[model samples]
Target chain A: MSADTPPRVPVLCFGASGLRFAVPVAAVAALDAAAPAAVSLAALLGLEPHAAATRTVTVTGGDRARALVVDAPLLLRVLDVGDVVPAPVALPRNPAVLGFARIDDELVQLLDTERLLAAS
Target chain B: MTDLRELVEAAGGERPAPTAAGAATTPCVGLRTGGRWFALEAATIGEVVALPPITRVPAAGSHVLGVAMLRSRLVPIVDLDRMLTGIATPRSERGRVAIVRAAALELGVVATETRGLLELPVADGAGAGDGTDDGAAGPEGASGASGASGGEREGVPWIAREVQHAAILYAVIDAPALVRAALGVAR
Candidate 1:
């Protein structure tokens, strides 16, 4: 790939409060393997927390670790680099979301792993 | 489903002849504002969406209604009716928002109705003022429903150009100039 083009990264696609969201696969240490320990994606994104949310995506960076509670895990897929579109300048400055990418005709907001984990 | 290879082969590769000189046409997105027809260059439009809730700002320009979150971006909503007709538009479910992009600024303009795309001759050659003189009177006179003459520009501005297409007169908006004026920035 050219230096300017972004590298294709693995992400765990999931839904939260009816809206689609994705997190980098690298940040996830485990999924649905442990009890509730991390923060909730809906809470961080200001969405209604669904009672049906059962999956936990455990995120770890260096010595820090946090779990993100979300709806049942859907798929772990490598996103097509071309489908990603950078966030517009008008969007509020929030580190939790980096940009958006299309997955199955749905525009899923890609979560910034580090920032999202820090929110807990 | 059509086979990709067959679809590509069936399409003959031939460049269509360009229109004759003086017959060139420019595509425009037609819209209705304050009960009158208006046109904007198709290239300047980003998308047409429902007018979302606007968060009003204090001490902002008169033309700037407020800003609204559009596709995760907070875009300024310019009240075209208020800007052109010197009257606040009544809130209604029929209102449409036209996302206009120029320079680095992307904003929305609340329109009464979106009339879809239109193709107009590059040059009408029918002289400047055609049909009812509403080109100078803004939307009020064009609609012929009210006498809001005070809102009309006494002098011709660079942003609004009077143009005629298919015997119908329209105020063709200059997107870039309009953006610059809305932001109060000299270019």
Candidate 2:
């Protein structure tokens, strides 16, 4: 990549409560079968609890970790840093929201695993 | 009080002779929502456009419907009806979005319709008042019901004052306060 080009990072995208969200691949330690003890990502985000979570994503930050349950159809994508823009200043500050990026003509809320785990 | 001529002169501008019958006016954009009339300062409004598809944001306040990409910027679309009246704006009633900007913040406030631009007479030394005057004259086709009774409702300050134009009352929105409220920023 040219020096002027922003670096692209891999992220795991998933759905929860009918909304799309993503977290950096580096923060995801494992993707495994759904665990009954896994916390609902939708509930953590203050959305209605998902009826049934099909998978469990193990995310880690520093020495802390969390098992977040999400709905089906998870996908992986690489996003350019420059394409990720901060949430509008008028939006209420949410610690888990790192920024926003448009992928496949859809707006995705990029998450910071550390902040998301801390907020939980 | 300093006269308008003196204020104009101090600003390095030509001072035109004042007319006794001319009242100061503020340019505003008239909006209709939930069958109620409202006006926002024109200077604070960026534009009014047809409603666009919105992507919901997680953890945002209930008043926030979602965000939309307008002019390559992610602008949060807020439900003014919900913010003031606790009623979510139905999709059938939302036809336009008013892009309002104040300080470093911007938002798309949902509207049922736009009444275009208007020049509203400014009340002299008018502070944002409690909207307690139930007898205020309303415009044609207006419901004549007051939605809010004071400068603040449920601790959120929004309306600057009620202005009468063509025998109709338009709640002049305090754009900065509304933006702050949407951001959940303390006064």
Candidate 3:
């Protein structure tokens, strides 16, 4: 915990482009896996706010609530919540955009949903 | 080959006879554009409302038409036609909003039209034509082809019917694709 680090929030691990971690509540979009694709997706057991790789990003929900789904697994090194900085522009580093996923003991690309949406 | 109706008749003796495919087709709201039918599994749909006011999400992509609020859900409505055909088409006469259910969160789409819920016949006629529109409807064909199978035949243009009066065109959307795209899970 440092003077500059931002606070940590609960996050879910999504394995996609690379190992990436994000808060489940902040990631809004997803895959319509089933047919008749409309789903009433219930809330997932949200991330454990304070653990390794916990990061938070504020977004303009505007009138909606969303969950963040990253494309990768979280890193081993824990991020000090105090050092986090939520910038209106793209995230410089700290929060991962390039990472890997732990799929059956293998690492895959996990996407950064927060940045993806923000970038768009 | 065993017909689908026979299989369903065997499983749930009381359920409607299955079509050609063995498993009972899930009740889906089929959105047909161009020549194919894209079914959004009914389970994923939250509320199907007529397209109200869609406020533009500045700098949003082509797939994203705009945003609309449904029952306080404040959903981000996507444009299925543009997302699929890759060619921009006129919005349906009865444009609609489809609130979708995902694994962790909910999303809404601005469907050109909301075809009433459908119980598709199993046989999505293999080797059937994709019912495409003009030269504009390219690129998406090869990419979205392998996935468009299993949609029951309805019409050439109105293949993916959103509703009876939807006057729709194009194929059914695989909800996962939309979700993945939103989450940046898929490229």
Candidate 4:
């Protein structure tokens, strides 16, 4: 599994308001359109560009997986390197998402893949 | 004369060891509405935040205030008014949200107003002090029926004597029952 293997495709989402994000091939908890779309910490921070705090999102702790609730937002697809990102500050609490990285000239929060799996 | 203890015992499953005088212990924090009071069983609360802006989800069903991010999970928001008051009012400036996590589930409730939490005398029916604010969506309140009625307050109004303008009565609500009912899980 080196240069011989192809990178996994990551999925992108287009929020109804036209917000787009690149999600990891693995960190997706579940895609639910349940009003007030439910999402996970990984899924919420796992996407593409967003202005800090301006993007209203609700985070909840769940069993096996935390839901990333979205409302009127659509989903897209992309490729994920499956990179494992650690949170800069140690979280004393659960669902603590990690800091950000610059991708394609846009800042994004790298999600911890292992933790997402353990929860899922 | 109906001894109140006899009335409670008459409808009892288990009774605590009674003191000879039946002196009441410390009072707990409970929300009052319609002249009645309710106590939220402690030991199960997670965190509390102001009611956040909720996006509507098509086909998600009423009572769901879209999803707000609590900590990190995307738990659906349940409008307590729809659960207890049987009405669906639009999200206005006056509302309270209480987020509680229990048994791997996190819940946020648009209480419209948050009556402070109180640890009350443990009643027999108060089984499971699970501290679970069940938010499955209960009784369907008249949706948007109160949109024009904006003069509302937040939190449960136990102190009816302190009523305010755009006043809506706060019912002594059971969080779990409202959720179950709204989710269509139970009657």
| Winning candidate number (lDDT) | 2
RMSD of 2: 6.6
TM of chain B, each = 0.71, 0.73, 0.56, 0.49
True lDDT of residue B35, candidate 1 = 55
lDDT ranking, best first: 2, 1, 3, 4
Candidate 2 CAPRI classification by DockQ:
medium
lDDT of 4 by residue, B35-123 (tens): 22233333333445667655333223555655554443345566644544557644545455655433334456665444442222234
Ranking by DockQ: 2, 4, 1, 3
Q: B176, model 1: CA deviation in Å?
A: 7.8
DockQ scores for all predicted structures: 0.05, 0.53, 0.02, 0.05
lDDT of 1 by residue, B11-127 (tens): 421112123443444556666666555677666777788778764432246667756667655577787667666687666677888887776777788887776445544444422
Residues A53-74 of candidate 1: C-alpha lDDT, one tens digit per residue: 5688777755677777888656
Error of 1 at A34 (Å): 3.1
Question: DockQ of candidate 3?
Answer: 0.02
Task: Please give, for residues A1-120, the per-residue lDDT of candidate 4 as tens digits.
Answer: 698786665643334222323345455544442435444332433333333332233222233444454433444445444332222221112232233323443323333444544554
- Cα lDDT tens digits for candidate 2, A33-102: 5566789888888888766556789888767888889886789999986668667875774678878998
- List the candidate 3 regions with Cα displacement exceeding 4 Å: A1-120, B1-17, B20-23, B32-37, B121-170
| Error at A60, model 1, angstroms | 2.2
Residue lDDT tens for model 3, B1-187: 2232234334552343343434344445654343444666565666667766653332346566544445433355665556555665356776556666554445666654445445543234312332312222123223343223334433323233322112233244456555655534423
Relative to the true interface, what fraction of contacts does candidate 3 keep? 0.00
**Clash number for every model?**
1, 1, 78, 49
Candidate 2 residue-wise lDDT at B22: 56
Model 4 misplacement above 4 A? A1-12, A15-120, B1-39, B89-94, B119-121, B124-176, B184-187
